[model samples]
Target chain A: MEHGTTEPGTAGPENQAVPDRPTPTPAPGTPAPGAPSSGAPAPVAPATGAAEEEHRPSPREQERERFRRSRRRRDTWIAALSTLAFLGLLAAAAVASPGWDRVHGLFLDAGEFRAALPEILQGFWLNVRMFLVAEALILVLGLAVALVRVTRAPGLQPLRLAATVYVDVFRGVPTLLLVFLVGFGLPALRLQGTPSQPWVLGVIALVLSYTAYVAEVLRAGLESVHPAQRNAARALGLSGSQTLRHVVLPQAVRNVLPPLLNDFIALQKDTALVAVLGPLEALRVAQIKADYDFNYTPYLGAALLFIAVTVPLTRVADRLQRRAAQRTRAEAAR
Target chain B: MNEPLLRIRGLHKRYGSRTVLRSVDLDVAEHEVVCLIGGSGSGKSTLLRCVDLLDVVDDGTVHLGGTELTDPRLDADVARRRIGVVFQAYNLFPHLSVLDNITLAPRIVHGVPRRQAEETARGLLARLGLADKERDHPDRLSGGQQQRAAIARALATEPELLLLDEITSALDPELVGEVLDVVADLKQRGMTILMATHEMGFARQVADRVCFLEDGVIREEGTAEQVLTDPRHPSTRRFLSRVLDRR
Candidate 1:
C-alpha cells in the first residue's frame, strides 16, 4: 500500500502505466527475446536471428493469425449486440408488464421527472456541500487519530487511549443513529455553544463515524510499511514525528488511497441521510415531491443523482486497487 | 589517535529470550576503517544496530564523540545526527527522488535550508557518479546505483562516523564492486567507518583492522593481514576458507 497504490491519471499518466515492468506484449505465437514473459515459455531463439532461415512467418502460422483476428472481431460484435439486445428486451418486458401504464405514470413520468429535476438538483447541492465539508474534516481528524494510535510515546499515552476509545465507540454506533443523536441530543441539552443547524449536526455525525474507519485504514497502511524502513529513518536522526511525516505517512496514505476513496464514496451517499435531520437535501426533496403528486419519479431522479457521483468514485477505487496490484506484481522486475 | 570517534563497551542485545549480541566491545578511531567479518547470525548487524542506537540495548554503553548514546537519559536522535548508516539492502525512501532521498534528513532534521540541502545532495550524488539521477526514484535505479544513492543519502549530513551493515550482501556479483569502490573512496577522504562484510577480499584490501564475530561475540580482532592471513582462531580460519572456496 505504500506508494504501491496508484492514483492513476493523476500523476504523469505514462509513468503510472507500468511503474514496474513494462510488460512486453506477447509476440505473435513465438517466444520473443527480452520480453521476459512471466509465464516462462521456452526460450526459443528468435526466428530472425539466423539469416539463412526465412524471416517470413509460415503459411500455417499466417492462417492461424488471420483466424484469430477474425474470431476476436466477431466476438466483439457478438458481445456488444447481444448485450444491447438483452438490455432492450428486459426493458421491453418491463414496459409490457400488466400494470405498465400505472407503473409508468407513477415512476417513469417524464413530465414529473422534468418538474422534480430542478428541486432535486438544488437539494443535491446541499448533499454535495455536506459531504465535502465532512470529508475534509474526516481526512485531517482521522490522520491525527491514526498517528496517535501508532505512536508509543509515553506522553501520548492518554491521547492514544482516548483515540482508541473514540474509534471503538463511534465506529460501533450506526451512522444514522449517531446522526440522530447529534441532531437531537445536543439540542435537547440546549447547550449555548451547540450547533443549531441540522446540516452542521449531520456533518459532525458523519465526521465522527467516518473518522474512526479512516483512522483504522490509515493505521493499517502505516503498519504495512516494513520495520526496516522505520529503522532507516530513525537511524538518520529523524524524530518519531518527523520520521512519520517524511517517511511513513506518505507511504501509508498512498497505500490506503483505494480504501480511503471507498470510504469517501460511502460518505457521499450517506450525506442524503441528513434529510432526516430536516435539511432540504435530495432525499427529502424526492420524498416531498413523491408525497405531493403521488408519483415516485423524483425518487428515481434522486437515485440517479447519487449514482452519478458514486459510479465514478467506485470506478476510481477499482482502478486504484488494480494499479496497486500491478505495481507490486511488477516489483521484482523493478 | 586523538580520540576514537565511536566507542562501544559491553554492548548486549537480545530479542526476547534469544540474545543476539553478547558483551560486544569495539571502537573506530578518526579516519579508520574497521570491518566486522563473520557468517550469518554472528551478530555483526546487531552490533552495528546497537552502535547506531537503532536497537534498545539490553546492556551496554556506546559513546559517539563523548556523548553516551546508550544512556537512557540521552537523546538518541541527537546522537544519531553524528552517525550515518547504510543498510544491507538499499532502503532509500521509494516515494522520494534520489535527490530528495539524499536531502530529506539534511533538510528535515538538520534544518538545513532546502536549497542548501539540494546543493549538498547534488554534490554527493555527482561525486558518487549519479549526477543525472537526481530526478529518478530509488526503484528506477539498478541495485548498484540504488546502493550508491543510499550511501550518498547517509553521507548527506556529513556524519562523523558511518556504519555499513553488509551493504553489498544484497547486490548481484557484478554490482558488488561498484558499491565497494564507493566505500573505498569514502575512506580515502578520511571518513571513519565501521562495516560488516562477507567480502574478505575487499576487507583485506582496505580494513585498518578486522574483527571476526562468532556466536554473538567478537572472537578475533587485529590488523587485516594478521587476522585474515595469520588466523589465531580455528573458527575464523574455517569461515575464511569456506568464503574463499566459494570464490
Candidate 2:
C-alpha cells in the first residue's frame, strides 16, 4: 500500500473529501509540525472516521510520560546534591593543606625539582601512542572472539568454548597479574623477547591482558540482542550472515557502546597498571619525578593527570548511559 | 475453486520425548484467509512455524504454490524465502528504526535496491499508521505499531503466503483493535493469510474458514459462522464454550 496524502484544504467543509478511498489527508488528526490552527471546519465522513481512530495518545504513551517526569525529578535532586557535596569537599581539603604552595612551585620552575611540563608531556605522548595501538588491537580481537562465541555453526563449538574459557580466566585473574605474566613469563618460556623499553613492554602487556576481558564484554553485548530480532530477519528470507550483518550486530554494538565506553575509562586506569612493567605512563612519571624532588608533588600530579584523562571519558559514558536508559525505559513502558 | 496455495500433510513434530504436533493435514487457497484457533499448547503456532520452515518438522510435507517444500530433494532455504512468518511477539529488530525493520528483508534477501526498498517500506509504514515513527526503533513503538511493523516486514519480502502466529495476542487490549485493523486491511487486500490466534472475535470477523485444533489434531474445520457461532461437534462446542466463558 502506498502512503497516500491529501491536500491540506481538501478535507475542509467547503471541500469535503471522500473518506476510505485512499485520500491522503495527513493521517486524520495527526498534529502536523508547526501548523497554525486555521479553525477550518471539520470534514464530513472519511476524515472524521480516521480522526476517531488515530488521534488519541495510546495508554502506553501516557504511562511513559509519567515515568519520564518522575525520573526527571529524581535525577535533578541527585545532580544538585552531588555538585554541592563535591565543591564542599574541595574547599575543606584546600583549607586543611598549605602543601599546595610547594606543589605550585614544582610545576612553575624547571630548575628546582628537575621536573618540567615538557618532560611530562613527552611521557604523555608515549601513553597516548600506547593506548591507541592497544585499543585498535582490542576492538578487532574482541569482536572476533564475540562473533566466534555467538555463532551457531557446529564446528565452531570448540573455538567458542576456548574463547569462553579464555575470557573467564583473564577476567577472573587480576589484570596486574596477567600483565606481569605477559611481560615476564614469555621470556622464561623462550617463545618471545621482551621489548627494549619498559614502556614498550608495558603496552604489550596491557593490550594482551585487556583484550581478553574486552572480548568477553563484547560477547555480552552481542548476546544482549533479542532472539526475536534474529527470527524476524530470518523470516524475511535473509541468509544467516545477512541477518547478522543487517539486523543483529548493528543493534548489539549500539546497545553495548555505553559499557564499551565504561571499559575505555577503566582502560585508562589500567594503563597505570603498566607501571609494574616500568612504562612512564602518568603514574610512573609521577613516581620517578617524586623520587628526584624528595616530595609528594609528583604523586599529587599523577592524581591530577588521571582526573584529566578520566573526567571527559566519564562524561561521555554518562551521556551514553542516559540515552541507553531512556531507550530501555521507553521500550519497557511500551 | 482454485488450487490451494498452501498444502500441509502428515505433519508430525516432537520435542525431546514430548509429542507437540501429531499427524495433521490442512490446506489454504490462494487469497483466502484461514484462522487457526485453539487453547494454549494446541500446536497451532508450531504448525505455523513448520509451514514457514522456522522449525524443522520431524516429518511432514508443506507444499507452497505447487512445489513440495519439505521433500528431501527440496532446499529448505528456498522454501523459507517463499513464506513470510509474523510471530506473536512482534519481533521488530530493536536497533533498526521502524522503516529499516520493514526495508531490511527486501533489500538483503530479495536483492532489492536500497532506494526502492526504502520507498516501499515508507509506504507500508505509513499505511500501517506508523508514519511518524519511521525514525523510531522497535523499542520505542507501542505493541500495535510494533506488530504493524512486523506485518510490514513480512510483506516487504513480497511472499506469496503469510503465516501469522497469534500476532495480536501479545498486544494490550486497547492495542489489539489496531493490530487487527491491519490484519483486516491485509485480508481486504487479498493477501493469503493463515493466522493462529486467541482473538476469537477477530477470527470470526475476518477469517473465511476457521479450524479448531485439539491435542495437536484438527478437531474440526468449517466456515467462520458455522464454526464460531454454530459448531456441530461436541468437542468444538466445548472449546467454544470455554473460550466464551473467559470473555
Per-prediction TM-score to the true structure, in the order listed = 0.89, 0.79
User: Candidate 2 vs. truth: CA RMSD?
Assistant: 9.4
User: Which pairs, if any, clash in model 2?
Assistant: A5-A24, A6-A24, A6-A25
Local distance difference test, candidate 2: 0.77
Going through the candidates in order, the fraction of native interface contacts each one reproduces equals: 0.62, 0.55
lDDT of 2 by residue, B1-247 (tens): 7779999999998888888888899999999999998889999989988887777889888888989877868766677888888898887777678887788777777788999999998888789877777887665455677788888888888889999999878866777887888889999999999999988898899999999998889989999999999998888899899989989
Q: Native contacts retained by model 2, as a fraction? A: 0.55
For all candidates, state DockQ relative to the true structure: 0.54, 0.29
For candidate 2 chain A, the 10 contiguous residues with the lowest summed lDDT are A1-10
- For model 2, what is the error of residue B19's alpha carbon versus the real structure, in angstroms, after optimal superposition? 2.2
Each prediction's total of clashing residue pairs, residues at least 3 apart in sequence or on different chains, is 1, 3
Best by DockQ: 1
lDDT at A143 for candidate 1? 93
- Judged by DockQ cut-offs, the docking class of candidate 1 is medium
> For residues A63-160, could you state the per-residue lDDT of candidate 2 as single tens digits?
44455566668778999999999999997887568876665565544453345444565666666677877888888888888899888899999998
Task: Please list all clashing residue pairs in model 1, or write none if there are none.
Answer: A1-A255
lDDT of each: 0.87, 0.77
